[model samples]
Target: MALVKEGDTITIDAHARSLHLHISDEKLAHRRANCQPLPPRYIRGVLVKYTKLVSSSSLSALTDFNLF
Candidate 1:
């Protein structure tokens, strides 16, 4: 999100299953270095628990039972 700015071009290739950001490597590196992590939207309850317990979707969205 931080890497993308207004007027920046983006391409989505469904067939290739890829996304392209039309920005220079230098610009991307600069954006990455300056990017800040977003604060958690949920502070408590099931959502918070879910956030802590769930693994990344790349890992198949498995819950870490050890967190329970």
Candidate 2:
């Protein structure tokens, strides 16, 4: 998960929240605590097709952050 974002404090459990927010930890910046559970299926396959894009883009982005 660190590849797309940071902090293990965040979660992707759609069953725990009202809306499925595919968001980052910054969304919790104003919150008191983040107790959201981690759902294994939530947004699971969404990245399958983007895998190659993510890998190559990330590698290219490392040398040129502008690509991100």
Write the residue-wise lDDT of candidate 1 on 9-65 in tens digits: 999999999989999999999989999999999999999999888889998788864
Q: Rate the local accuracy (lDDT) of all candidates.
A: 0.89, 0.45
Best by lDDT: 1
lDDT of 2 by residue, 1-68 (tens): 22333433444667875433355556545342544555544354656545423546536524334665
Q: Pick the candidate with the highest TM-score.
A: 1
lDDT of 1 at 28: 93
Q: What is the TM-score of each candidate against the true structure?
A: 0.71, 0.16
Residue pairs in steric clash, candidate 2? none
Which residue pairs come into collision in candidate 1? none
